[model samples]
Target chain A: MKLLRNLVLAAVAVGGISAAYAAGAASFPHNLVSGIDAAGWDLSVRKADYDDDEHEGYRRFGGGHERHHEDDDDDQGRNYGQNGPGPAGSTTPPDNGLILKGTAPKVQVN
Target chain B: MKSFLAVLAVTTALSAVTPAIAGEVTLTTNLRNYGGPGAYLAYYVTDASGKYLGSLWMSGGKARYYEHLTGWYRATGGNLGEIAGITGASVGSGRTLEVTLDLADALFDAGYELHIDAAVEDYRDSPNEIVVPLTSDGSGQPVQGSRYIADFTYTR
Candidate 1:
């Protein structure tokens, strides 16, 4: 009987630890990279302006090399108001500071 | 009996694992017609004693320009990780930026304050432009900024 009770207590403790870990992970999603279309922020009108064929980079003349058209700079690869610190290949992000990191906020720009 | 102790342990564990209660807060920032390039804004929180807590959001994604947000830069040393995955494009002149996030209930009515640092290209930088205490009484009340930002408000 004592052994059974010990096993039960151990199971309960493990379950509690697992539950806490899951809740903590759900609260802070470090990998969530939402776009301008996230909740409460809709920039679809701005993003739609760059969804044309010219904005897309593809293989020219069915060759192996992919090339962007000379006039493709207008959209800047359609990354306006999107994720990350800045445009691709701009610069590496700075180091982390001592300030505590918090949850990410959903944004809307009008 | 052993059964009673086991029950008590279960109850204690459950309560200990409970997460802090939180609520959604909506932050609105309206910019004045500064007539310059897009403005970079940093929205962060600090305690009553002026200790940096964390960042809510960062407008403008360029790390090089983050130093222009003087207040935040001084607090976090232009830490990109402080706003990683929480930044977006800069807000243009006369435009508005609205953000919503789930904040811990303890932050409100606990002597904490929300701050914004505004900067514009070729224009003067405004650090600590708007400093409003995060209290129930301050909610829904619009506060004017010193420079680029015209008005700022928070709603729970």
Candidate 2:
């Protein structure tokens, strides 16, 4: 009867220890997952504003370069030469009338 | 009786040392010169069947831009909690980002994969930029990325 009691007690102690170890191992993965999740979210928010601005700039400038105009005063003079060499024909249409249109370049992970 | 005692001592020592033997692993990703401002990179893990396990690291720091990481966002539903503590600075073009942490031993030799989703401002969002299998044989092997990432490597 004493031997039976000793075996039962030993079994319970081993079982208890094993259970604790298993629990700890299981929680390790969850803790790691949670920790990484928080860090990624925080990083994402920090760069959001910069990303938005970049997107806007790409849409406006095409590829980060601005279109240049020679001179406002010489605009009419240049057009005059192209349109029959007269003020009447030159003044009919504007020389700098070029329309730029296109959606912003798509942002992608690379 | 002496043999039984020896067996118990060995079992105790093995159990105590097993956790300590599960050392840490570091992952390094280097981006290419894509000519963009900064690249937002998401490092995540997936199970054998391609099910999302969890995020490992996030390079860019922005909440709104998380949606641009379409693959991660779709799998995690833009869950911010998945990468909170593991967040860091955005990686510039031609720059490298490294993350080191103690990973469970079981994760290796198990059918798992590490995936990266990269996005830059005004550029097309590239999901699954790099996908590498997790295996004992794959350690220290540098794999090239498809779009933005130049290469990725893992070391113990």
Candidate 3:
């Protein structure tokens, strides 16, 4: 019975040491950062929290808060190609290694 | 027999390098005067079972607004490589856009379809605005669109 009790005590000590090690590792900054990343933590959550506070402030004041910054970013109206006065636009068909019967692909806008 | 062997050798060499039969196809799209901004159009092909084959032309240069073309965005997930060199400027309202390309002959008279998705800035998106079967008999037949396109035709 004494031997069984000693074995049980040894198992309990080992488990307690492992638990303490886990707690110490979790307290480390690098392990915490990695844990946050592995948990899919993004700045959007913090942004949303900030927006909530800012929105409350805006409500108290007369100013308005733009909650849809992502949408506004998409509506910037960025033009990539130029609208030229040629028969077609400024871009032409690329030699995409497509076998053609005659000439290359041509586009015209009238 | 020597002449026959020589002719056979030449024929085999020619056949070895021969490409698939391709012909010129002119795709014409006429947009209605919706009075909005210029419209983006995506021309793509699909098999009879609605499997996307490839994109033929993309009448818009900006990749940011490609999501407005729902059908194409769904098919290609807005992969710019699919329309890398085949992209042009957006067509204005009431303008006619014509594109001539050499397409494989097997695409026609087969159970394939051509789809056009149109989108206008600050306006509605028209997915599959025009879906026409690609067939030799369907050439020159003007197909009507739902939202932006007035008429679309394919001539071989």
Greater-lDDT candidate between 2 and 3: 3
Per-prediction TM-score, chain B alone: 0.87, 0.87, 0.88
Candidate 3 per-residue lDDT, tens place, B1-156, comes to 999999999999998999658878999999999877678898998999998888788886656667778899999988776675566778888889999888788888889999999987657778999999999999999999988999999999
RMSD (Cα, Å) of model 1: 31.0
> In model 2 chain B, where is the ten-residue run with the lowest total lDDT?
B80-89
The DockQ assigned to candidate 3 is: 0.10
- Candidate 3, residue B58: the lDDT equals 82
* lDDT against the true structure, each candidate: 0.72, 0.64, 0.74
- Across A1-110, the per-residue lDDT of candidate 2 in tens digits comes to 99999999999999987898788853446677678887874424443354544434223121232223232121111222221112211122111111011111111222
Q: Candidate 2: where are CA atoms >4 Å away? A: A1-110, B1-21
Per-residue error at A54 for model 2, in Å? 17
What TM-score would each prediction reach against the true structure?
0.57, 0.54, 0.60
Interface RMSD of 3: 8.9
Native-contact fraction for each model? Answer: 0.23, 0.01, 0.26
Query: Who wins the TM-score comparison?
Result: 3
Which prediction has the highest DockQ against the true structure? 3
| Top-down lDDT ranking | 3, 1, 2
